[model samples]
Target: MLKAAGMLGAEMSTTRVLLALLLTSAGLRRSSQEEIAEQQDSSLITSLLETYSAVQMPNNGSMPLRVSILISVSNVMDVDILQYTISSVLMLNQSWYDYRLRWNETQYPHHSITVPLETVWTPSFSIREAHTVETKDLSPKVKLHSSGWVQHILGLRVDSNCNFELFRYPEDDTDCQLTFSSLLDTELAFEVSYVNEIENVKHEYLVTTLDARTSHGPGPPSFSLTLHLQHTPSKTVLSLIVPSFAVLIADVFGFMLPILGNERISYKVTLLLGYLVFHSSLVNGLPGSSSCNPLLIHLFLSILTLLFISMIETIFVTRIASEDLPSWMSRILWTHYTPGNQNTGDDGKRIEAEEDRVTEPRSAQEMEQRRQKLAAGLDRGFTIVYVSFLLLFYAGFAGTWFLMECHTEARPRPRPGF
Candidate 1:
């Protein structure tokens, strides 16, 4: 029984030793595999770099390199109406194939590798209308796939020039474009794709449409991003048009006061002063452009002139009713009231007496009645003329506004593509 127990103990010890040996062998194999992978990765990287040249173009000079670009607009920073410029943030994803950077999948454990952007050849792009452009990389490194594809991402803050159409002003809509072109002399084919990922950007102008288009010419291949912006006229209408109309209505009703009193003249003068203030504010608030000025400016000026003319007419009528005119002026005004020469005989005396009575120095009541009648006739005629002018002016303005609206609606929009 002692011999059998010793034998069982020895058997247990051998089994334990074998298990330890197996574990050691498995660990060694795993460590070797890891080392091998590391060596292979290093070798692949070394080989790729040794053969690569960043200054050289990706493909042979015989054919143009085809590059695909994706543009994503992140935000619209500002739209300057005075400067006619637009500032925005854009993310560009540019991808191309480089045979020099390719590696066989079986030879390397990594299906993709990250390399510094400076170590790879990239196309240089510039904007045609941009006055200022700042570029930043999404990552310092670019991704290189085993199949020879490369992707680079960058962000740009661009301040580009835009032509603004302000004929309708507060009711205006404008189209702005950012054109990007390659600076390299080597022939290149560009495929542009666009997506708007804008978020949390608010302004008086809202982006109504976004489009991308490509153009090929003798100079270079170009891509354009078009942004259609619509102005929100609510603010302008409330601030400008409403107040202008109110002032105009008040001026029109000023005629209700009797023209013979200082109250009417003073009231008209006050309205004129108030309108001048409004006009000054309007001119100062609006952006000025030599090419195109808003129709609202002209409308304001016309209203101002009408108000001044109304005030002048009021003053003239007041003078006519309140003050006596000179003899020569009265004779010119009432031609039939002139006195004839005195006669020497009875018949002449009778004629002279009749002339004196007809052209007599009238009493206060009679003279006042005649003056009031003349002033009332002049005032009535002016009121008719003023009302007619206002009607014609407003009708013309409405017609112009309607035609502009129709024209804008009928204009064809550009189609987006590669």
Candidate 2:
């Protein structure tokens, strides 16, 4: 029994020791497993910190954004819309980077981009308002610059709508002064087309630069204009020449009066003086030098010539009217003796008949009648000759003046330097 108990105690003590060692080993294994897990967690945390540090981001919480610019211009403003578009891009730093080029199949490389923009500026006004401008007027011009990218351009779109009134008749008291404001885009390429209802006209202009403002940077823009007058026929100094020549035609008609009377002589002299007055006045009004206007000089000389002819005719008519022929001479030419009527002019009988025979009273009457007819015929002949000369002079003078004017036009004139 004793031997059996001793063996049991030894087995129990060995089991107890084995149990303690097993507990110690199990505790060490658990602690080691916990440490390994902690190490793995630390390495993961370090990796996460490294990843966050690699990315650079602004911490102020502001969003990344680019600058956007806007530009616009009026289609019908007074300034040129074109000049503002001319620009050169300045590269601030070129040494740090190499440029990359992308091209299409056409072999055109993409060094620059041309942005196409669809923008329109149109004048907004009614036909009634435009027409109502009347003496008041509104004109606009447009210009554009072809050298800038459409997208990057920035400028103001100015729509300058204004009205001005001018007096149609110079005698009228109305006068107007106009002030033009700035244009839409001070810097851009633009063009202008305008409709003037009041003027019943259309205007177009290239907007170059502006005026009215005195400054330096991109000077003020302006709309220059040239007005075209219509071809409505007007009576100028040129058209008056024909009517002036007609005044002398009246003098020609006055010469047809009977030459045997004092009345006719006075009329002829009076008409000649009137022509002299008119001719002198005309010469004063005309240019002193030779003129391209043909009839001017010809009319001057022809009238003076006509005056001379008239004065001569007057002197001849006056002398003839005052003359008295001898009675014996006249009776001899006029007497027509019928066998019974040829009576003697004495106190009695044929003593008078001897005197009458020499006097020839019937012959005298016939001769006087013949003289009157000859005088009239001579007057008509003189008038026809005077008018013929006038027409011939006019034709020759016109041809010569025209040739001279054309000659002057053909040669080039030297430029004036001094």
Candidate 3:
């Protein structure tokens, strides 16, 4: 019986030892987990930046740093044709990798960390054609991932110079560029991306296409964002083209009035004056460029010239009808009344009488009738010529305006050095 009690006591001692070992191991594990959590919360950032140098380029200047650029255009604020500038609201996202900033997630317990931009190295860049740049962020920061990736986001209101092809004017589609170039001497390989979040509304221009490309030349790398913008021509058409067409139609129909009365001449003079007002407005509405001017300007000027010529023709025809025919014209009209064959005798007398009958009218009523017939014939001939000229002129203008490519080839501007 004593031997059995001894074996039970030995088994109980073994059970106590096993339970004590398990409790000790559980406590140790809890302590270790708490220590790790504390390190992550407090020391992770300090450890990362303890040896980091913000000014040094990654990879010790051996290889070109690869930077991924994403430009999200939220709104096109304004496109100034006269000043040759475009203003935009843009969100710029730039990302790169730095091996020095990397850390083991198992130890750090952080997927990513937000750090002040002054804490790490970042790519420096500038807009080549920027006239004004405004930053929206009061305090800028960067996001560093545990996997060595760094992301920087910026909000900007930029007014950049744009070379616009205004040959087609209101119906034109122009290409404008926003060129971003690296200011750092350290070489950079760029991967460019573009996102156009513009909504189609009543804006002056619609961004029809977006293209992103990189330039790797003798100098630093540059990334260009080309926006293909189509103009909204409704307002121009209503204001300029419609009014010009109406004036031209009115001038064409003005020939229907009687040329014998003063009404037609006065009417044409009034139309010409009104057209001058419209022409002045047209000139003011379209902004001119040194490279190429809008064809619409020339078209309006040509219309003005035609209107002036038509008025002059009306005055000349009216004067011809009001007065008697000149001697030279009467000779032409009456071939038999030649003065070269006349002698001082009955033949001369008869020739003089024939000249009187040809040059002068018999009665006031007959004279008026003759004037009316001559004026009507001349006016009819002019009407035919004027209408025919207008038809041909408009046809040629339409063909040239629609079919011909008039825009100047865009040349690359010199990249400004930082």
Candidate 4:
């Protein structure tokens, strides 16, 4: 019985040790699996990070592998024209960011990316003549840069379809400019054409023009260009011709007013002069360019001609009034309603000599009446001319405006490739 109990205790000890060993082996296997899984997870995370890491930029001419963190410029402010904040990275080499990046992302990542950016300022661009804008003045507002800078590159796009002119001085030799506050895209170029946008602010871009306020500047006075994305290049001949015709009509009537010596001559001259001055101011408001905006030339010519005609007519009328008329009537002339035989003094002829006249001053009265009648007719003719000219002018204006409205039609378009 003792031997049996001893053997049983030994067996129990062996079994207990075996059971402990089995549990230990299982635990070790689980640990090994957990370690492998951790390694794989680590590798996956590293790959992801590396794949989407910050962009790389060429330094001057050399390529350096550096960590760059991209930070989306959430809201671009006015102060950013000078400088703005960038992402903080432990790496010193990654601190420098390049501004020449093309930002293309619907939802930019808020996190900082690891990429270098470059800022570059390009030279001024040349603006040619023959550019036409809806208005003479360009808006002062401009957008130098846009937000959502994902990688190191920030695309600077400048589009111009309005304000095709720059007012250059005689001494200025440099061309007009379109500059950015930050940097510019030297690889890219500029394009401009006629577009019909009412707002000059819609085409906000990073191009700059000369500011003529400076003394002896490089180019003419520069105005900010407003792009009209919604407008297209299309205009009617009538739109180009109507304003000119209106000015011409007003000019023609200006001549007749003074010619008739009408009392309202001053009023007519004033009205016509006002139109001429207003149109002149309007033309001068536009930028100076070699291109012929037909309307402008037409307005200038018409106004000048009208003024000339007015002055000439005034002189002519004055001369006419100063001229001497026949002595049949001194100031006024009246008709002598008498039988033919009444004046038959000697020769039985229905004639009366000056000496044999009735001496009633009828001839003078008649002459005066005739002169009054002529003056009245002249006044009436002037009035008619004035009214006719006005009607024609307004008619042309209305027609031109209507045609412009009809000609200006908007059509949808695909996005332009930058």
Best by lDDT: 3
Of 1 and 2, the candidate ahead on TM-score is 1
List, residue by residue over 1-418, the lDDT tens digit for candidate 3: 9999999999999999999999999999999999887777568888888989998888836778898989998888689888788898888899999888889988877899888888988887788878788888988999999899999998888888887888888888888988888877447899989899989688989999899999978777878888898999999988898888888888888888877769889998998999999899889878787668898998899889999989998997886677576767544434533333445789887877777766554444555565667678888898899999999998998898888876666554544342
Worst 10 residues of 4 by lDDT: 85-94
Q: How much does each candidate deviate from the true structure in C-alpha RMSD? A: 7.6, 29.4, 10.4, 17.8
Q: What lDDT tens digits, residue by residue, belong to model 2 across residues 166-249? A: 111101111111112124324322232222222222312222222221222454332221122121113323444554566567
Kindly give the stretch of ten consecutive residues in candidate 1 with the minimal lDDT sum. 409-418
The 10-residue segment of model 2 with minimum total lDDT is 89-98
- Model 1, 1-418: lDDT tens digits are 9999999999999999999999999999999999998898789888898878898888656878888999998888688877778898898899999888898887786899888888888888778778788776645678899999999887888887777777788999988888777766347888899898876445788877789988877777778899888898998999999988888888888888997769989999999999998899898877766656778888889889999999999998887788576776555545533334334688987886776655666533555666778888999999889989999999999888768542222122222221
Tens-place lDDT digits, model 4, residues 1-418: 9999999999999999999999999999999988886675455334433444233322333432122322221111121101111111110111232344223233332223332122222122222211211211133111112232322222222222222221111111122222221112122222212122122332222222212111122333222222211211122123433554565566555544433345436655665676667666555543343442323444356555655555455544443343354455323323443223245456545345533478446644544455556555655565576557657865775565335321112222222221
lDDT of 4: 0.36
- Candidates' TM-scores? 0.80, 0.33, 0.80, 0.35
Q: How close is candidate 3 to the true structure, as a TM-score?
A: 0.80
lDDT of 1: 0.81
lDDT of each: 0.81, 0.38, 0.83, 0.36
Ordered from best to worst lDDT, the candidate numbers read 3, 1, 2, 4
Residue 306 lDDT, candidate 1, scale 0-100: 91
